[model samples]
Target chain A: MTSGIRPKRDEETVIAGSCDSENPRRVDGLQLLGEYRGAAYEEPRFLVYRPDGQAVLLTPLLYRVLTHLDGRHSLASVAERVSADHDRAIGPDGVRYLVEQKLEPLGLAVLGAPVEQVPTADPLLSLSARGVLFPARMVRTIARLFAPLHLPAVVAATLGTLLALDLWMFTSGQADAAIRTTVGDPAAMLVGVGLLLVSTLFHECGHAAGCHYGGARPGAIGVGLYVVFPVFYTNVTDAYRLNRAGRLRTDLGGIYFNAVFIVVLGCAYLTSGYAPLLAAAVLVHGQIIQQLMPTLRMDGYYIVADLVGVPNLFGLIGPIVAGLARRGRRGGRHAWRAEINLRPFARRVVIAWVLLVIPFLAGGLAVMLLRAPTYIGIAWRSTAERWTAVEQAFTHGQVATILIDTFATLMLWLPWVGLGFLLARVLQRAVRAGIRAVNRRR
Target chain B: MVEDMTVLEREHVEFLPSREALGGLVNVNIVVPVNLAIAVLGSAALACQNAVGIIR
Candidate 1:
């Protein structure tokens, strides 16, 4: 009954022979966060981490091994216990190999090794640019305050209220009336924009609250500039420690809060006869749909990812493709199995996602690139029109029109601007990768 | 717990590296640009209203 340990296999981390380290210390901030018995996960997994750093999973036996790496325990000591527990003959050399090759490389253990970040080949469509809005400490405090809102009874009540509101808004002709009132009145339009922003911020809080409710600590809240648009985010990266239900809750929490906001907006509209509030309620439904766009790093993207039990779907593309190539070259056997370490169910889901995603994003980006001139000209013309509208509003002294048109003009051209930034970033990564590949070739 | 007496028992507990289930640096984010969505949707609605003489 010997325990075997290996890092999640990737191109960078190769299985190597026995190592030479005699003593390895756990990194200063490293921690073993305990076992994950989340029912949603296909297997029992262990969690280890450093606050605000990477979260690594380990096997049960490997979790045991990590527990012994206090720098005081000799390689022979760990090997002896593991050998006894595993009922196998693992020598000190074997222990050293596990520590040096597996743990140290992942920033878990160190033996005077220079700390280096593991290189991740992020997917082409990943949202890599981000900045924090609220620090971890503050978000944690705020999230805890909102935790009660997710209590089972409260969640049920909120959902019921949301459902009832939707029914009334559509059936009672409130939604149509609200939209007309909002669009025709310039001030209502500007207020609708403001409400959407506020609702988005509220949505981030939902994620934080969900994480807190799930017995996991949430980090900061922030915004990330995903390829072309600003996306509000709450760093619920800590949610990995939770079970499948908990993780899913974190993923769906944003939209759930949107529901809550809608309910509040509906109530306010009914109470005060506020047209703009009702307008916000209506426009927010669009935000909900947009959030659910299955592509990109949106809430929908994460929902799919959590459902499949895969974190980075894009990262698996290279390995899965390589596995396919190997299958083709090696008589089409179970060679792909060696490439992906997922359970069969998750593996299939991930593969299907890769199939659909690659062409969709590639084709979409291709069209965007190919027709760049036409799109840019259109954007420029639209912006100019809105600008002219703003000038006309000023001449007529229509403050509401000026405000609403001004907001629309700014938003109208941002997506095209985002495309430009996306191109620059992708180029930077490709150039960096190219340089590295060239150096490796030498 | 080293009393695992057989390979079958050991098979279940072999320690291996785990893959994180979240994406990117911050895991998940709501990528919908509220400002943009409301802008486009509002513009189209207003344009329709103008055509039908509501905004005038």
Candidate 2:
């Protein structure tokens, strides 16, 4: 190997495929790291340096192989195992080639016959690793059910009207008294509760339909937590491939649909003065308020993401915050300058003073923690009460209201947690894939 | 575990030379799930406020 080579003065001597010989030895199994051309490896990549000082960028596949190559496998045995796992045969030539190309460079294998170095691949994206809440089957099914629909403009119009009515209800506060009434008729209260749930479904449908109209394929929809916050999400990663206008359509689509539903619900409420209609109107209007909150991750965040062309705006926020923190730790004036570069805003402010990072992270953690017990309690209470109500079938069917409300709550909260994980995973995968594809071409 | 990779001949380094069509890298993030979960939870929480007579 090019030995006796003098190092250049200025450049950081990049000794390609040479091991550090003078360093102290590590444990028997743990060896060196390898380095490759930085351009070849992407971000979210890890580098391992052998105790000898040579660095290697572990590919996802190579990383996995290495993990399984305990002392239990001989050189040929390891080769056979890898070949079997990868659905290929690793003959002597293949094994030797791998040793020379990958394993040798990382200082894990020898060049000639009986090479021993084993390369590993990066970790697989596991659901359990990321704390997936529901079973994969359940997640898939719900997501399919919530999949974006290609509806007629008439349906879109109906949603838009509903959203408008919601705005009216909130702005007018006409539904407030009816919703707040305590001594209401039990039947009326039950109907109101049902209408409220129907409105939420309309809101979700709006998101799916908007995605369709925007010419993006909508994947599964489900619920999960964002940090600690319980949420329901729709998969619109397909929209990322669309142009700016298409993305905007998809982003604002949910609210538009919500508005249309509101108008219809509001008109009905006004005409009949029914308490249930008023409750439904209130429910629809609440979406507008929740969605518009910029501090929260909602439709508005997506709007901002689309507006800024940063489809993963929320994801970027964490990195930006981390970068700032690192700078601050290193006494960087830029980091301390408190110049926050959010997707839609660029400003200088006291991020720490604003407690943006702390509260945000804490809130997220809180949501995640609350998800389990709350869901459990809701399930337990709802089922027990519903069953009890059913048992007294002839006496009073009043228990139906309790059961209905309980199921509605579960349907709502369960999805928030389940879909959060799903959307994050699916869209993140699509974005990563898109990036890799672009990089490969370039 | 170290090997002198740079010393290998062209034939020995076949693993690095073979070209295969790469599929696009999908960065499967959990953002959608988180956002949707939050919205659902938030809306549900709000819905519960009415159901339990918390707001009333």
Query: Which residue runs does candidate 1 get wrong by more than 4 Å?
Result: A1-22, A36-45, A59-64, A87-89, A116-124, A328-332, A395-397, B1-56
Off by over 4 Å in 2: A1-174, A180-183, A222-232, A294-297, A328-358, A363-395, A408-442, B1-56
Tens-digit per-residue lDDT, A1-442, candidate 2 = 1111112333232222222331111223343232222121121123344332233334433543454445445556666666666543444444555545655544454333332333222111212113323343453454345434434566566666655665776688777776755114445655665565555545555565566666545554444444323344555544544566766666666666566666776788789887677775666566666675444456765665455433333333444566666764655655333323231232222233234545654565466446646655555564454444334432554454445445444443443454456557656667877987999999
Instruction: Report the lDDT tens digits of candidate 1 across residue range A336-402.
Output: 5633557888888877887877777777677667766765665566667667766766877767666
Instruction: Encode model 1's per-residue lDDT on B1-56: one tens digit a residue.
Output: 23323321222221222221122211112233333334464355347436434336
Clashes of each: 5, 97
Q: Candidate 1: lDDT over CA atoms?
A: 0.65
The most accurate candidate by lDDT is 1
Worst 10 residues of 1 chain A by lDDT: A1-10
In the range B18-44, model 2's lDDT, one tens digit per residue, is 000010001111223334433433344
Q: What does the lDDT read for residue A260 in candidate 2?
A: 64
| lDDT of every model, 2 decimals | 0.65, 0.45
Task: Report the number of the highest-DockQ candidate.
Answer: 1
i-RMSD per candidate, Å: 8.8, 14.0
